[model samples]
Target: MAGSIEIAGLGKTYREPVLDGLDLTIGGGVFALLGPNGAGKTTLVSILTTLIRPSTGSAHILGVDVVREPGAVRQLIAATGQNTTLDEYLTGRENLVMFGRLRGLGRRSRGRADELLAQFGLEQAGPRMVSTYSGGMRRRLDLAASLVTQPAVLFLDEPTTGLDPVARRSVWSDVRRLADDGTTVFLTTQTLDEAEALADRIAVLRAGRIVADGTVAELTATVGGQRLVLLDHDGTEVRSIDTDGTAASLDAALGAVPDAERALRATLRSPTLDDAFVALTQSATDHQEAVA
Candidate 1:
């Protein structure tokens, strides 16, 4: 059987190709797509959510072709874009209830609205107009509305773009809970830390192609192993030496340092997602330039 999401030779173009020939498979859990702006992250999400058709190739969500069976795909999935889709005129509770009604929940709409409001920690604000809510509150309500039908697949495009740290984590917790309940989440984020904190697996996109795909540790390894930093008395970095994260390698690198006592301290730093993202994307760009 095909995975939850499958793509083959996918391409989209406007003026120039926004997405080149791309293939990816995601089975389940929270799969994050990380890319800089204009990397086609949103374009891909738009394709999968049935909002737009690919210029070429094909994609499927749970074996339903996004192009051929858009209605079927819509039935199985829901999307929350960067902007909130909530109505400012409606109360938080009313917004969710309205979504449920549109989804044909009928008499069950009110109950489901209350349930979702409570799930997203918006029960107290449920009766308040969304226009009066904070940015975080509006975001939570938008997310809640997407779940009115409990979709099998959920697509979040930069779900926490403008929220503060606390609000961002709150959304992260909600995403985790959804995955735990067996919802396949496809997340697109520009924030490296968000991918590190939440992704079960991550793929980095550059120039409309995937340059790296793996777990946080796996991707970080692509950039190389840990780094040894020598710091001055003022705690500024004097030098950084790459290491394989073994004691032998650390010792060998340290031994070559002249006047080691001049350094006040040394620290081993693990390669982060940011490091991997930069190295991988830069490599891809360099390769493309060479090919051209």
Candidate 2:
């Protein structure tokens, strides 16, 4: 089973403080740590992965104290940073085998690496240097390398950042497989759809603080009033929402007032994840600079 993570009063500073008394508890399959650029997302993951130390607060990962037992914490966690961690000079298979050996695995690690390469659809490219891999392929390899020992807690810092849709979905599939095997995944993503699609719970960080936290539905509802949407035959939905709930109100407005619902056949009638993200993650700075 995956272990729980408890973080209390997490604070970090770089030139300026990034995290300020951030508190969070995560214990589940997939936890999406959401934030925009420079929102301390990377910094938070760094501390959790023992790559950096937090200035303050206590964090426990899998019952190990990150501050006091960093090495222990590292051993329990597998991480794929926002940037590629694969060595461009080494073949994909080599990278995996190297990590496995680093984890103290012996010659048997080669067989295991080959299995992962095939599983990730990189079997054909396994022997090629990572320099020849595409962004998506590299991302997949990075993720695969992290799962070498089947770690309990996995940290993926924007794993799908530069991948194509199909490639992104492939990465997501691998992540789901890991989570289903009872790995606790802490993911950071700028893509709201990725968060909504994969995260069991999500937390929003802005200006070095958690502005919101909850499941996708909960966070969206907590932030925005309501939304109106027009959907296409192919299940494509376009939403428009305001603080006044105009987007949603209009859809129901005519129906309520005139008692006639529009004949929108097979149209999705929910707010897209993007609308919810803006509402939940947008800060006072956004509010004040709203195209005025």
Candidate 1 minimal-lDDT segment of 10 residues: 283-292
Query: Whole-model lDDT for model 2 versus the true structure?
Result: 0.82
Residue pairs that clash (backbone atoms under 3 angstroms), model 1: none
TM-score of each: 0.88, 0.84
Candidate 1 Cα errors over 4 Å, as ranges? 238-266, 283-292
Cα RMSD for predicted model 1: 4.2
The residue-by-residue lDDT of candidate 2 on 1-292, one tens digit each, is 3348989999998788999998888987899988889999999999998878999997899889998999899899899987657889999999999999988789878988999899999999999999999888898899889988989899999999989999999888889888999999999999998998899999988888988888888887764564344344665543232444665555564343221324543232354456667765676567434311
lDDT of each: 0.89, 0.82
Candidate 2 deviant stretches above 4 angstroms = 1-3, 228-270, 284-292
Cα RMSD (angstroms) for every candidate in the order listed? 4.2, 5.0
| Candidate 2: 10-residue stretch with minimal lDDT | 257-266
Question: C-alpha displacement of 79 in model 2, angstroms?
Answer: 0.4
Indicate which candidate wins on lDDT: 1
